[model samples]
Target: MTEAVFRETTADPRTQSVPLSHLSLELGHLYMEDFAAGPERLRRHFDEVRIWVEAARASAARRTGGKRPRISTCFLIDDYFTRFSTPAELVPLILKEAEEAGLVIDYLARESGCAVADRIELAESVMHRLVESPPPGSHGSRPPVSRTGWLANGQRTPTTRNALAEVTVWQPPQETAARNHSVFMDVELWSEKDGRRQWSCPFLAAVWQLARLGLLRHLGEPVLTPRPWDGEDFPHDWDRLPPLLRLNDSATPFSAYRTCTLVPNRFVAVEDAVRLILDQTDVDSGALRQVAERSAGEGAAVPAAVAQRATYVFYEEPIDSSLSEGT
Candidate 1:
């Protein structure tokens, strides 16, 4: 028998261990249209969110065996989709309204951060990691999601048929894991315009949720690590602001073993798509191992499945339905 030893240093990769809190609680999400309606919208949004915040904290404490759990509150602004007023003009208003409702936003993030944080193309990386759920009888002949730009909880209803096949009619899409009824969903991950790619909202939101769950990494290094902010004045341009900002110095760690997001009912479909995307993604194994180890050491371990680690509270939107049209 011949024994040879040839090893490459890069063969074994290590992930950066980020501080993981018990729960990362998302207080609310903001869109340009919400701001366009002025402070009243934000005031109403946070007022509704305040009660849910307390409830989420209590739930986290229960999960931690009634011990005081480390929970961090965060808010995401949709600066990627549409730019409204500058950060300088809009951020203070958001802060004031949230404060008035007795809610402190420990961290603030821009939606674009999930797309590209600190010069890393996070959305593209996540797109590459996606492992789509195959329907029954699939034999792995389908194109990868990176090329298809579409993901579904199950196989999409056929729009075309084999030229030589027998007579057929349109078929209804079916969920892969349906119990009795099928709730099929097909999500467009991105679209290209003039050679420039535009990621969909739900795709970006899934990356954002992965970041909050401490499950995201790029090339073995953590991405979207929060930068400290001491309540300083924000820049007039949205691009000047950091992707993730730590508004409160004494706040819990930004990354956590689990996450709870509170959003308006209008976002249910989007959030459902986010979960579907996450359900099939082959997340970074090194990061997953780290989270598992750290969480176990903390006494309350996270779930093995990434999608199961997220929770959401979809409350009623605090605005007139007609005024929210096209928003």
Candidate 2:
């Protein structure tokens, strides 16, 4: 009788590796309401975004020492919290507006994919990895943030007290990394209805950034790898579309060393919360190492901190636009 020796090796496919671009530039995000308003809505948004996109590209070129940086553009549509139109009717319109603005969307993704990409419970997995940031006066004990579904920049002030309890002064929340003055923020991570759980927009958005940064993995395997779209007709249903779709055949890879999102001013606070989540969430070390090694091999300097790798440009929304929370 013989026994085979089990040894862990790097050759295992579980350690999924993805191609990386120098930058993943997000032109804008789409919502049902945004698109339903009309193509003019998409046009105005992209028209304003076109100039900023050039700025972002120029910035990336400088970072690469005047080299032609490999940049890929992506757009995300909100399909999880609220589904409005199918891919067939929505994608072409989005592409048309981007083209008119002299923009190219190399990749497109669905918001719900952040929650469950390719059948993987990505949001839940990220939730488990969240480690609350310790504020100035943090002790060994902390709040149950995952259960409570709330995350704050600093310790929260107690809002309730019994009459029998001793009187005390009100404590204002402080930002962990605040300067002389405090700019505190508290974000709700998710909500529950009946037995099902719904992830918040910021939380899903954070996951989306991680995926674009190539920092996510499922049991050592990459999640949400882009599916190629060869100009074939898009599906009538959202589920039929892949979590990530590569629209341009000549475009660079989906994942990148850094990401820059050019979104409406309305999403600035949401992106801030996303950065908060990234600062606290612990990503897979192996995946992080892979990104670093590959980037260095190409003589690029990727930021060490995952949270700092993402940047955003807050552009003014059109005067006629009405921004909604779900978007």
Candidate number with greatest TM-score: 1
Per-model lDDT: 0.90, 0.89
TM-score of candidate 2 on Cα atoms, chains taken together: 0.90
- Which parts of model 2 have CA positions greater than 4 angstroms off? 1-14, 139-142, 159-165, 321-327
Task: Please give, for residues 172-283, the per-residue lDDT of candidate 2 as tens digits.
Answer: 7778888898888889999999988999999999999999999899988889889888788999999999999999999999999999999989898899999989988898
Predicted structure with the largest lDDT when compared to the true one: 1
Model 1 alpha-carbon miss at residue 138, Å: 2.7
Model 2: C-alpha RMSD to truth? Answer: 4.3
Candidate 2: residue 110 Cα off by (Å) = 0.7
Error of 1 at 154 (Å): 1.5
